[model samples]
Target: MKLDLTDRQNQVLQCVIDAKQQKKRPYTKGVVSRMQEKGFQITERQCAYDLSVLARTKGTGIIGMRWGGGRTLWIYDEGCIQEGAA
Candidate 1:
């Protein structure tokens, strides 16, 4: 499904996907902090909201907090189209 997100939302989701692909846990707060460090200017609450949308939105196939020892992390499901997929 197409996610009707703003450009900044897309960027944050892309970052989460990249981090997961690299075998790093994409925790909401951590990702937000990293993005801010890189000058993205996103807040933790915003990240949480986006992540919740990803998890709850149908056809997005974005998984949340799976098997990470209780840490709030997220990853896109394998069948979901990635941010940059053709």
Candidate 2:
């Protein structure tokens, strides 16, 4: 998708991508903490909002699902779907 993300949103997306690449769960809290550790000021609430927006936005290739009895949220790319049918 042609993402029209703000600079901050792009950074948030990068954090999610990094976690996916590392086979780690891209939870809201985790992403926020990772960004903060890297000196990228972000809050858990804001991260959660970003994830929700990204997932709900069309053609973003980002997908978010709730697990752990709907208490846990994980974000990842819908890579295969975005690649289209072979």
Candidate 3:
């Protein structure tokens, strides 16, 4: 299904993308926090929701967190990219 993201959601997604690409690392709480400091204003809950949307509709790989852990991480599935590019 096609996901119709709001401008804010797009901004959040771009933030995630930039963070991942810039450091060649997964999405983390620190990354999100830095993005928030840069003016994203998103909460951890919102980030989780956005991640869910990306996983379900956009097919971006899920940002995983260890069970009962503090850090968060993402894996960008190449399939998601190819699908989006198609």
Alpha-carbon lDDT, every model: 0.73, 0.74, 0.61
What is candidate 1's lDDT per residue for 1-86, written digit by digit as tens?
66687777677777777777878877888779768877888888988887777677655556776464766777766565555331
How well is each residue in 1-86 modelled by candidate 3, as lDDT tens digits?
55578776666666667766676555556546766777877777777777656656544443444446555565555566656631
lDDT: which candidate is best?
A: 2
For model 2, residues 3-76, the per-residue Cα lDDT tens digits are 78888787877887788889897668888988898798887888888877777666656677775666446656
Off by over 4 Å in 2: 78-86
Model 3 stretches astray by more than 4 angstroms: 1-3, 59-71, 77-79, 84-86
* Alpha-carbon RMSD of each model: 4.4, 3.2, 3.8
TM-score of 2: 0.78
TM-score, candidate number 1: 0.71
Better of 1 and 3 by TM-score: 1
Q: What 10-residue stretch in candidate 3 is worst by lDDT?
A: 58-67
Q: What is the lDDT of residue 65 in candidate 3?
A: 47
lDDT of 3: 0.61
Worst 10 residues of 1 by lDDT: 77-86
